[model samples]
Target chain A: MKQEHIQQIGAAVAAVAEKNRINHFYFVACGGSQAFMMPAQYLFDREIETPASIYSSNEFVHRVPKALGQDSVVITCSHSGNTPETVKATEFAREKGATTIALSNVEDSPLWKAAEYPIHYDWGKEADASDLNKGVLYYLIFSVLHAVSPREKYRKGMEAVAGLNDAIEKVKTQYAGIVKEWGKQYKREKLIYTMGSGANYGEAYSFAICLLMEMQWIHSNAIHSGEYFHGPFEVTDYDVPFIMIKGIGATRPLDERAYDFCRKYSEKLMVVDEMEFDMTGIDDQVREYFAPLLAGAVLRSLADEFAYQRGHDLSVRRYMWRMEY
Target chain B: MKQEHIQQIGAAVAAVAEKNRINHFYFVACGGSQAFMMPAQYLFDREIETPASIYSSNEFVHRVPKALGQDSVVITCSHSGNTPETVKATEFAREKGATTIALSNVEDSPLWKAAEYPIHYDWGKEADASDLNKGVLYYLIFSVLHAVSPREKYRKGMEAVAGLNDAIEKVKTQYAGIVKEWGKQYKREKLIYTMGSGANYGEAYSFAICLLMEMQWIHSNAIHSGEYFHGPFEVTDYDVPFIMIKGIGATRPLDERAYDFCRKYSEKLMVVDEMEFDMTGIDDQVREYFAPLLAGAVLRSLADEFAYQRGHDLSVRRYMWRMEY
Candidate 1:
């Protein structure tokens, strides 16, 4: 991300903190943007005393929590800033006297107009990792965390964010060749399932929903690794395709167990283990929290390779932007 | 549910509320039990001010929230009352000084032994609707809600529970033949998807994970109806088999959009719409909250019918009890 963009995010968060006493946090978005917010929510759930919840944008509007008021901070994101539900959620949150922040790649978007604080992140080929949507969300979340309780993890986390762009790029470069081999090996498969737990579960979900089903039009679903043994594991067999994202930190055991089981029964199993990746740019103290975002970044290479090998353009869609629901 | 079970559940909740300040709530379980707690969590998220969150059993143990304390109330469930993670979680919650409640079909089980409040519900063929797992959960959740905020919804919900057994039975009988027809049509399908939104999403998740995948070893997934528009909707095609549970009240429009789209694209679509059902035993004011549990009860017949038509015994399992994870 450029220095100007980083400065702008800092200023926006600062302004919100000055004007509002944020006792609760509500993160709302749709599709990929929603998936992107999970790690931050997970962090907030563990790291803070105050409540934070993530919701599908429309669900936020439909089931407006009674706690949502002047003390609530509502953060919403949409790539185009025109996603109807998300824009409306921002508007609704503002009307409820909550602090509303909008993140979008588009300049002067509907979400930008609706929210009290609007921050733009960069996207597409020219965008750096810091320029991506996570930059805006991480800045806001970390700022809030620092304000609420200036703990070491939150402080170290903010310092480490500066290195993440390079760290993620390194991981992506390392995975590029491997993903191409994966692309060729698994090109013809029609259905795939992804699984992970804790922080990285969001990456697995995003990979399945946005990368596979939306971008590739391949039937896919994300199974939480901890929850997998409960029921979904019965589907395990030699022909089944599984992508396992083994997270770092406390939940690793859950992913490892699922991985061990999957490797035994499934012939077509792919893994992106955070333990195997070299995240040199990130600080060791805060690396666990960054694993999901890192895993997600590296997996984007896999999606791209799959798109290439399958001869499908990632941007091509049957409905999404092509039709009105 | 029997009168004894009803009385036992009420006393347990009252005891917990008396001993503890009841500041926060945590629901933990595995597989179907975990899915079962979702409706209660959804209701608590909407109905009360004291925050409540649900987690898969193991994740709850691993990521024990900072909020879990002397003032917290944790409710756990496992059909056998022996799910390792759930037992561990109950123990952990108690260790953290939270009042722990365990719901199970089995008496003298690990989870039952671990919790401060252990309530047994009837299961299998002899289990009445009130005697089933829902009896333990619904009563506990309703009683807690009444204690915290005795809103009409909570009081009316308790009164309505008495009639629910008969109402759910009626819905099941009405769908019995319809499910058999569905079983015949969908018998040969190797893969299927289930979708719902709002209150009934838990039913969709439970039906997909526990009913289809675990019991039948079929590859299945639950796609949130609201999320279908985001990415999963791309999977819509003539041959794709989808079972939709349409929720009532606020989020009905979300489910309807997916249903409308899927009906156009998919030939093999089965639906259980709460809007179509005669929920006579339930009060109109609180019917929306009960829709998920009711939908779950009725869909159990669909699962049974599928097992029959597929020539698979629902009791047969490749992993669950057959071998260790």
Candidate 2:
């Protein structure tokens, strides 16, 4: 968000690249944090020769990758900085001689203590557009991208991300009416399915798990557009509630195909199309990668509206952090 | 399968390796076929240096990998050998100069025509355990592993697979009573959720989608066990129906934790523990990898029993091959 934050991320990435060969990148965390890394992983797969993967914190620890050594970077996030497995994962990565970077809302938290580079990203309503957790993730992703391949376009991408708040604000106001309309429709939903493909699939997953299932206590599952035709499509009927995220990416066609099929069958189909979003600052070359960020913003607003319509607090969780597993 | 089938797979893999420098592998298919490739993808991640990825057939075509070139191998499957996307993906890979392999139930089908190597595998009731599509996949996977980095133990793993029919048959007998009981409980159920981790996750997904959703038109989703703790755990309730597949892989503990927690919350929790299955011929070292194959057999049996209990024919489908998407 801020130039200073961008500089800090760049410097951190540069230091890691200087210290390690950095041939592989791993993004490990739990829940929403893990889902948040999907876009970045997709970026790495498309943009760099070095491999990158996202994993649940426990899986990263239990099935420790042989490739995760001195030449690797492991980035983990925990909003509370006290997610046990995430802290353990950061420690495990550090023990394996990998560069560990952690993002949490609390500074010097348990996760921070375990990481070599600790970043505190903003969360909750007070956090402005530029300093949101997604913003920090964009900065970290592009900073790592610059460190790995030093692409001029990637640097431009970071510049776009640096000045996106104005654009983000405009889109939120534009989406408010639709959000209210959809919130009313979704208020009584007992089961809703979110579908998308490519990087946007992460947004769908977050919407399904974090917003619908966790926040509203609704039954939901994130269905990959590419996978919808397989077995999932068979569940389609007139009464099915489906929310589809349509991205303007290479995988857009996959989403379109699924969207086309679903609209014909399901009456309660809501779509959040990236084409409607105003990503004014993002360059044409990398707009597809940032599409998820835009859609995520709209979905977050929709989540808020849904919360209002249902009279449910997004923070009200039956299990998470409330009970020991 | 016949020893010749193993020899044939070995020869094909050897030829590909000798002709090209294979640095990556891609498995592309649709639906059940796509889910089927996940375990082999896991195998490649754990056992080989060359990275392997599984993709829904369309995603493979739409998001064509930059890594897929002369040094890559693409394996695509379409059981009917007529899946349009599967054919196109194989052709795309071959056009990119990657060695392409196609597995189909029908020989000389379109997908086979597009591939550099074409192999047919048995399917349905008449097919023996050793000649099933899964058996063909195992042969192809191990063959590639042998060609990539030959190991005596891996060869032994193959030898174990070579004569696993009696072991598979034995497990079926042991699992029969439980499958019928589960069928009776699951017959009237309209929704089911499956969870598992590591290679065995493919089994969980296949059970959820192919067996439940597509076959019985039940609403179901496969949740990754490692991911179960994050947001999915909040959805667990006393009446929630869960089919958790417990594997003996590196991520088995993740499954165990989810299983333990689910048992406390969900009264309708059914488990197929790999520990309870008979893997008589599969060596201890490789048993974890084969757990999915064993679990898959049991689930397939469970699917059959469910269908009988519900008076729903497993072959009946509302869309697949019956309607155009």
Candidate 3:
């Protein structure tokens, strides 16, 4: 991965913050862009006036009213930069006189052209690095956004991302072993339910989509861990795999509750707990910020390995129609 | 069925608005309360900048760090008004020196007592109304809210509710007919999918919940109309009931797309389409808005009649739980 691509992301975010002094930020994108924005949105919402609303471009336009204005900076994220809704929204906001920033892997994508000051990720050459490349781009953008937003937050995010990088190798090794061993058990599973809380909820949905659409080619539902109680929990059978994602911090108790319930009710159960990491040296406050990201990043790695081991063709696009939007 | 009860609801809302001179309004509630808030929220989001955010009481503390402040006025809705998180949140906000208004049916419920101002819909003598009572209470609360909020939209709301009342009657008659004819077909179905957009999306969920927990002991899902395209549309076999809510207005186009697609792909498709009575002299806009309220109000009648026709014991609560703070 190009270190320069990461630096550029950080710089662009910093510049936007300096120019707009964005007290309220709205990150508008869809799919992976929305997923990557979740962690930063949570952090920002915790410190400032509600983490900026993250909207899938179409959702922003159709349901949510005019949230962006002169005081707001809208960030449109797209890997290819040609996402129709995002580009349309960028132009729409510009028409209404709102500032815009585009974040993308391709420099000349339509998103970059539509933006006032587009930041290029240009990590196209390192797409093979997969999660590492995508994660770093988001981390750098988040770092700059933190600096621009509740400026008090920049250092904490920097420290958290750095600590995440340090834990990367161990996370990769641990996940590799787990995926290789347990993935076979998923073959006969009738349905898979992936559940998580906070920042990891998006990741759980991503896993649900990939498993049902890409790996198992079966029906899957990803739910907010708490929401399982409302109805879907009753549908669990002995043949279904209940996957619970457990991270660290205050929300850990809720995930623990979900895990306990899954163990009691689901005959086939799996848990990915991140408490094994020795983040005790890190302050509890910083640990709170890093926990979900590290845990989800690790879980994502395991899911990727599991998909490959199960003979799911990573090169093939099973849900190609997702691109029709 | 008591005209006095309906009048009281309208009067209560007007009184609250006049007393507060409320230029802004906030609605906080979870689950059923949140579901009930959907229609009013869409109306407010369209006409005013009084930004509305919905949160589960437990989540309000964590999710809405900076969304609430001293200058703002909050309205918390709970059917029982005893939901733990909402009560605790009301207390927390009061301690933080913010104003709160609670709306509930129970007279002395914790949430009702905790608010700086509380509006209680004591249909104590009229429990038979069930969900219809909730609608009347909402009509009252929205009228009061619109009168006081920045938009002073009470007149428009009263007019809207009156239109809804007319629609409700027509819907009752038509729904009775639909349930007598179609309710028998639903008995053998294992999976039911409810889909809609905007305000109707929330209604779709309520319908699914009623079908599973109240009407039939079956598995059901309420999906946003747009999201069906993501994956669930592939599951449209003869075994599934693809119920689409086709209301008019902003979400009309999206719902139409779903209706058209379902008609082609699914063998068992049911649609509740917008219908209007002859108001030939009325303005086109009024006629337009009238169509949706007419269509949606009728679903209430259909839901109740369907339950009865299916030989489903509406009195036996399959899912029952207590809310604790």
Candidate 3 is graded, for docking, as: acceptable
Per-residue CA lDDT of model 3 for B36-95, tens digit only, reads 666665655555554555555555554555656664566677778877767887887767
- Estimate, for each residue in B263-305, the C-alpha lDDT of model 2 and write its tens digit: 9999998898889877877888788887788788888899989
- What CAPRI-style quality would you assign to candidate 1? medium
The candidate with the higher lDDT, 2 or 3, is: 2
* Cα lDDT tens digits for candidate 3, A159-254: 455455556556666666676556676655545667776666766765665435344444555656655554445555555577787867545655
Q: Give each candidate's interface RMSD in Å.
A: 1.1, 1.4, 3.9
Please provide TM-scores, in order, for all candidate models, with all chains considered together: 0.97, 0.97, 0.83
Best by TM-score: 1
True contacts kept of 3: 0.14
Give the CAPRI rating of model 2.
Answer: medium
Which model is ahead, 1 or 2, in terms of DockQ? 1
- Candidates ranked by TM-score: 1, 2, 3
Indicate whether candidate 2 or candidate 3 has the larger TM-score. 2
Per-candidate DockQ values are: 0.75, 0.67, 0.30
